[model samples]
Every structure is written in C-alpha cells, then in structure tokens.
Target: MQIRPCADAFYASELEPWSEYISGQQGKDPGYDVLGWMIEETHKRGMEFHAWMNPYRISNSATAFATSGAANHPAKLHPEWTMKYDNLLIYRPALPEVKQHLLNVVDDLISKYDVDGIHFDDYFYPYPKGGVEIDDAADYAKYGAGYSNVGDFRRAQVDEVIEKIHNLLVAKKPGIVFSISPYGVWRNKASDPVAGSDSNSLQNYDDLYADVRKWCQNGWIDLVVPQLYASTSNVNMNFTKMCTWWNANSFEAKLAIGHALYRFGVPAEGAPYQTLDQLSDQFRISRSNKNTCGSFLFNATCFNENKINILSRLAQVYADKALIPVIGKESEAAPAKAGDIAVEGRTIAWKEQPGMRYAVYTVKPSSVEGKWDAKLTAVLAEPSWLAPGAGNYAVSVLNRDNAESELSQPVKVD
Candidate 1:
C-alpha cells in the first residue's frame, strides 16, 4: 500500500544531485535498496508491500520538471523519443529501444528486491485531449510495417511491451505478481457490445491504445484493478454499475476495485464530494461480486487525514487482523518448514525465519477414525499461544506475504 513517487526516472535523468539531496534528507530514496527496506519494514508491521511503477509516463507537470535536472532529464536527453500530445508527456512506446529500456528498469527491480508485485496505474498512453493527436509518426515510420494504421501500430506497441514484461517477470521470479490499474472505461457500448463500462470519456482501448481487454484475455497480468472513481448517479460513468461490468468481463485474473476514498467528503461543483454512505455502497457492491478478490483504497495518504471519519470506520471494520491479498495461484511456491517451536506455560512461540511466516493450526480428534482434524487457527507475523486442552497441533510456516509454504510436522500434546 505504499505510494511510490517517481524515482527511477530521477536516476535515469542523471539528476544525482537532486536524488542524493532527497535521499540524504529522507535517509533513503525509493529505489531498489530503499524499497527493499520499506518492504522489510512493512512486513515487520504486519503489512504487505507492492512496488508501484508507472510504465510509459516519464513526467507529468511542471513541478516534476522543476525537481528534475536539465542535461540528464529524459525529455531533454531523448527529445525526439518523447510524445508531447495535448501537453501531456509520454515516452514513445512504439520504439523498440524505449520498450527495452522500460523492461530493463523492471528487470533491475525484480532481480534486486523481494517485492510482492509490480504495479502500474492508469496512465497507459496519455489520455487523448480534444483533437490533439499522440505524435508517433516517426516511430511508426521506423517500426510500423505490416500494421494497417497508426492506431493499430500504437495498440501493437502496448501489447508487445506488456507481453514481454509479463513473460520476463514470470521467468525471472515466478512467485512475484504483475498487476495493472487501467483506466476504468475499457470502451463505450457503441464501440463494443460487450464493453464493461459506458463512459463517454477517453477509453483505455480507443484513446490510450492500452487494449486492456486483450491483456486480460491473454492472462498477461495477475490482477486488473480498474480505477472506478466516479459517483453512482453520474450518468456517464456510474461507479457501482461499472464495478459489476468489470467483474463480469474479467478473464480469470484477480479483480480488485480501486476505491476512491480520496474523493470522499471533498467539495466540488455539480459533482460534490461523496458522502460516507456512497463509499459504503461501493464496498457493498464489491463484496457482492463473487469474482472480486477484495479492495485497495487509492493513495494510502488519503486515509491518514481521517476525512469524514472514514479511517476510523475502516479501522473498526479491519482492526488487528490484516488480509494477505491472494497472489496468483501459479505464483505460489513450496511451503517452508517451521523451526525451533518452544512453549512457555499457556503461550507457545517460534522463530519466523527469513522467507517464511507463521500460521498456527489447532488439531481436533476425529470421532470415527484414528486421523486427527487440523484447522488453521491464525496467520501471523509472529508466534502466539494456543488454547488450553489442545490434543494435537501443528504450525504451518508460510511465505508470510504470500500463502505459499509447507506445514510443519504435527506436535503431540497430552
């Protein structure tokens, strides 16, 4: 649940001065080493960490420009390689070199750190504005043979990068999950009869060239968290209706609704800030969907403000207990064995070794057969006590962050 700022581009820009300055003041940058530290810290606090990375976007506003250095900046260094359509900045994804470079960045992160997953948000190709077009003519001319038009070329470009990234990630680290948060609107009903959403706004497929449907069908990503950040009555994009639409369309991968808790209680003209009731309604809808895994609130910082008492209510609902979001079934690895189990009166304890977490199970005697029934009692970051009068029990050690682990040999108690 970490809100990652753009740091890889900061390093690529050779703005070591700014990078060093920020790292020195903050004690660490959000690069591989820093992210690794954060993962360990979050795990210590009984939470899982996902490394969020934006794929094709280099920078957005002037603020990013100001923080960046001149000579080494991405736009400056690769002027011809950038697309400045509608004043939004985007790297030319059609270029093989650009795709390779982005892959290299991901490769470095995956190889170096033990991150749970690689995350990409809704900025696929810059949202098309007015009549302004994404300038990829030069790239298309250079690499666009066989494709009929620029649109097809652009779509193919995104597809190629996504497929390559997915394949490489699984190959390098089969246990790590790959996820994307594409723009909620896959397409309008007019465009595709089976489209999940009906927004008049820019579609991930039509405008951004992100062919999200194809990605889902191909199973390139482990999860698809669409950003359904609109109110219920907004005729163009009703949140609840869209959530159901997405769940219906998702192709076997985990589907988690990106809850817009940030918009809760914020004032706006016409579409005023949503009330707590509206937020609750969205949660209920998500829960009702059988295919839906769970929910992740956008931007963790939003919860800190306690706006409209949402955090208090959320904490009440999810106190003490933490949920380990289900990783891809294929990502599960062999379980690790529990070691050095010890007892002190009513409390039993054991070491949660590196790469393994603890799951305490209680055993009950079978009425009919010699076999005993084992039930998972708790999945925790640390060891804990068992109830008194336990007949037989075993502790299963799991990967802590993921549910992949082997059960420890059953211990007997009289």
Candidate 2:
C-alpha cells in the first residue's frame, strides 16, 4: 500500500522534523509517523508498503506561496532551482545542486524511517509547452560539455540523480526496494522501434528526458510501474499492446502496470465514457504476462468513489482473498515461530507487536514423507481472526517490510 500524506500544512511543516524523531520511536506508531507509519501498518496486515514520493514537485500552485510558513517553504528559499515556463512552476532537474538536494531528502527519509521501498511516479520533468524552453542556460554554462545538445544534458542530470538515490538506498538499507512509474509512452514507433510507445503526442525519453529503459537495464530500480492509461481500442495508444511491450522491454526488475481508474466514466464532448469491460480487459492482459508482477490503482480517492461498480469488479477478481505481495528476493528474512494461540468460538486471537504481519496457515495429515505442507490461509490486520471454519491450523507472522521472522508454532482449529 502507498500512502500519500496530505500535501497541506500539517505534513509539510512536520516532514523534516518528523524524519528526525522517527528514528527514536520504532513501535509506538509504526505505521503513522513520517513514512514509517505506513510501512508498519502494512506489516501489521501482512502487506508490503512502498514509499511513494514526488522528486521535483515543490508546491501544487504558486498562489499558496505567500501563506506558506517560513521553515516549510521550498520555493522561497530556493528560487533559482525553479522554472516558470508559461504560468506553471516546476523544479529545475538540470542542476547538480538540485539533484544533490533531492537525494539528501530521500536519504533523510530512508535513514529515519523503517520503510519497505522507495517509489517515484510519472513526474520527472514538467509537461512540455510549445515554444518556450526550460530555463537551464545558467546550469548548462557551468556543467555542460561533450554533450552536443541541451536534451542530453537534461537526460544526464536525471540519470545522475536516480543512480545516486539507488546506490545510497541499497547501501544504507539493503532490505528496502526502489521503483519508478514513468509515463506510458517512451517514444512513438515512428521515432525508433526500441525508443517509445505507439502514441504520437509526447515521449518521456525525448521530451521529459526520462530514460526509463536505461534505468531499468542498469538496475537502478527494483520494479517499474509504467502508467498505461489508455484502452485497448484507443487509436493512438492501446493499453493491452503497451503492457506486452513493457513486459518484453523490462530488463530484470519486476514490472507492475499502473491503472487509471480515475478516468473510468469520464466523458468528453465526442468520446464516450469507458465501459467496465474496457477496464477489465486491461487487467486480463496484465494477468497473462508472467513477467508482470502485479497492478496498482492510480489514486486511493478514485478507487473509493466506486465508479460504475468498478471497485466491486476489481475486488471480486483480483482480491477475493487477502494476499502477501512478493517481496524483493534480496530482502527476504528468516521465518519466525508462532507463539501462544487461543480460540474463542470462531474468533482466534494472539498477542500483537511491532514489525510483525500475521499469516495463518493450515497443514493436513498424510502418509507420505514431508506431508506437512503449509498454505497461507489468512492475513490478519489485527492479531485476531473471526474466520468461518473448523480445521487444524497454525499461525505464522512475518515482517512484511523487512521479511525478517520465522514461522510461528501451529495452532489447531476445532
């Protein structure tokens, strides 16, 4: 689960200070403090939590600039690091100082928080404007060389930032995962076969200077969640075709598809709202690919809307039962033993602690050797269960974020 802290005053003022304080309190509010709270909560429920962050976004709108407090204000302190193309302001990714500052922010988060992973979404550089170029002349004059054009310079800047973040995170905390969610299209096939998506409008590689393929091939991220927001029948960009393309192109890291549920029933003057079948078809394609690990919905609010019974369909198909998402192989920890277990009618309860996500398992008796095969039966959000059934069962709890515990002792169910 990815938790988005409200981008309002309450969070911005506390981000840096909270980072410092989280290192001391590990268990009390494991899933709510800074970024650690979310991870801790996910662990409690036997689910992995990825720390989703925006690298360059400072503020939503410049209008809030005046009212923002002094300590939490990003634009006021670093005016040179910002660019105003038309009216929209964006962080300047072409500066070395900019890269260093962003990396420091990420390091701070990782060092202080017990997180499972670090994630970046589709905003590397700002969306492009017609004739106006990003104001990076001062930066280029200072650092640009050998590179023929400003495009390469911008690409190099983004690459350097991502490379540094990846290395530092793995070195400091090898248990945490790193992932990126780039725009659906890399480049049009007309530009280069291996360059980008089939869409004609914009490319992340050429326009935004985000070389997602290079990052994947170089092992800079543990997973790639490309936002394939189009439908299979769309003339410009087909969702199904793009999923197959991404699966083929992904280097070694896991590939997860990003679904745009926000646009489920949104209609324009001529184009009709997308039907439920169109959305379901995309998931069907993703499930078929072995390389495709899983799928992530765009925003939590949109999913909560339950548009056209979309959420119901998704729950019925993808999440009929709770699941323990695949963790990074390198971060796997030894399973822990199950301690005391008690049953009260249908409700089973146990002691709860920090850094533990509980999974209940069942074992059957057999004549063959190694007959004790354990299958995951339930993931408990709390340290209790009211499951309906009578059977022999054993409960094991694993640290979902760190995967650092042994399987618990078996408890029988009558």
Model 1 clash number:
2
Steric collisions counted per model: 2, 17
Residue 275, candidate 1: alpha-carbon lDDT? 62
Q: List TM-score per model, in order.
A: 0.82, 0.82
lDDT comparing candidate 1 with the true structure: 0.69
lDDT of 2 by residue, 1-414 (tens): 433221111122233222212333211232443444455666665566677777776545455433532344444567787776655556788776677777777776677666678888887767887887777888788888878998888899899998898888778887778889999877788887765666675788888899998888888887899998877777677787789778988886779999888887676412423577777788899989889978888878867787778877787666545444554446545555656678888777777755566777766755886456666678766778876688767676766543434555556667
Candidate 2 total steric clashes: 17
Q: Alpha-carbon error at 384 in model 2, in Å? A: 6.0
What TM-score does candidate 2 get on C-alpha atoms? 0.82
